[model samples]
Target: MSLQGNLTQQVEAYHNWKKELIRQIGRYRLWLQDNNLFSDDISARIRHGLELLVEDELTIAFVGEYSRGKTELINALFFSEFGQRMLPSQAGRTTMCPTELFFDRNANENYLLLLPIETRIGDLSLQQLRKQPERWVKHDLDERDPEIMREVLGEVARVKAVSTAEARALGFDEGMLEHDRNNPGKVLVPAWRNAQISIRHPLFERGLRILDTPG
Candidate 1:
């Protein structure tokens, strides 16, 4: 057989295997749901993992220095189909906090959840925030309206005033503080610690997730 023929066969076999794995994951999810396989909390987690697998979730994480173009990479790679910047990818330091992009078919409407940076004062970790959705300030996303979408997406850049001591407790050091951003009684900081954006996109519909973080 020709070399090209052999390579094609290998590629086809890999895809076939992947499809079978996804199907099995789906079956497992159904089995868990139908049988009440575990406690409510445990089951929820197990089911969530299963669903992502069954849906063939592909998560890409971009992490680098402040001006490293991580957002642009995400836009060009996945959101370019929209022919416009969906996220705040621009020339300057755009992404002030970590952001996650994904789609949930179970979600009835588009939304963005901003978990406050102040929560760190309560010693609540990211895992704790997952269980405490009430702690996140939720925003409705309107993709159909470009103006609204722009306003909504701009929330990532929201800033708040915090005392230097409070900022230090959040792990910011003197060297990290921007002199020009300081106010008389407080230092400016990103209003949010993290963001979860749920929107309907073809790539996300196919179970793709993008994790963009500051490096």
Candidate 2:
């Protein structure tokens, strides 16, 4: 099956699973309510399990240090020629925040949404992004409106130009730290602080999953 077909199958399977689970829960809850048997232990455990199951969705996370080719891997794996344009993967710290990718259906058309971790709608170029590390903000899912999730993703996925200052801020410096083995008085400098780019893909359906985490 094609990637889209496979994704559709997975999503359908997940929906079916979720519906069955909900039905079971409702049946159990109704039985308890009708019997007036509200055992605290049983009730609490069921509630907790339901909460966890409700939060369970297909989530694939890709993580790596700076310049570790995480973006390239995604580009090669899922996107075709047209889809490639939707996700602009490059060789730098291109992504500053966690990005989520999911498929959306509207009027019988399927489009991929790339959601970012920001609220304000502002025009940000890649070049400008590379210069200013502070321009990008961490995304808070609770504070954001669900209605605008697609729009936020659309904007965030646009490739912006990186500036020299932004590049430095992203730890793109060459030889900033050097280890001097010959000199007794030489101080050891750390090479680069750990930086991570995460991509949450909807490929995994209905079970929280993580893939490719660096130690």
Candidate 3:
């Protein structure tokens, strides 16, 4: 079996185990209720615990400086089935912003949501912005074509030249940007503040979320 197949099998097995465990817990709770062995507070606590278990997600994060192979490792480990690099991995800083990969069960569709760097000027935090769908630029994904997917995914690494004042206004440190002779008085910075990629991969569908920190 391919790596993707193996991972899918392992995730499915774990999912089944969780379902069986939840069923066993439910039965125990019922027994407790019938025997009058648990108080109202105990029952509530048990219910809360079960809710946590059901809602739990597995998050794996990769953190390092530029050109550290974080993105490359991610492609090799989870996305090799694409027969090419799924995420943009190159010789230099490719991931311009913190990128999240997961499957949104609620949406039930594959798409890429990009938060513009201009949004950084707002008072809202990243977490708050996520709730405001209108604030993001949505790109519907076509997984059937790997070339199309690659083209869309490459947007995460896109950068644009901006004036120093503009970069500062976007919450970027002017000192971090180097002076370029090719583009004097212009600072290059990431076009997007963050990227949220939703796909229908097996591991992701099983509640796995991968965080690729900025490179």
- Could you tell me how far off, in angstroms, the CA of residue 155 lies in candidate 1 after the best superposition? 0.8
Candidate lDDT values, in order: 0.76, 0.46, 0.89
Against the hidden true structure, what lDDT does model 1 obtain?
0.76
TM-score of each: 0.73, 0.41, 0.88
- Write the number of the candidate with greater TM-score, choosing between 1 and 3: 3
Error of 1 at 133 (Å): 1.6
lDDT of 3 by residue, 57-167 (tens): 878799988899999988897777789998899997789989999999998999999999999888999999999999999998888998999899999998888999999
Tens-place lDDT per residue, model 1, 128-192, is: 88888899999898877756776788888677777888888887775675543446867777788
Best by TM-score: 3
- Residue 62 of model 2, lDDT score: 84
Summarize candidate 2's per-residue lDDT along 83-159 as a digit string, tens digits: 33333355544444444443322122233322222311236544445356454443323112433433333344333
- Local error of candidate 1 at 168, Å? 1.1
Per-structure clash totals for the candidates:
0, 12, 0
List CA RMSD, all candidates.
7.8, 11.7, 2.3
Give candidate 1 misplaced runs (Cα > 4 Å): 1-17, 22-56, 81-83, 181-185
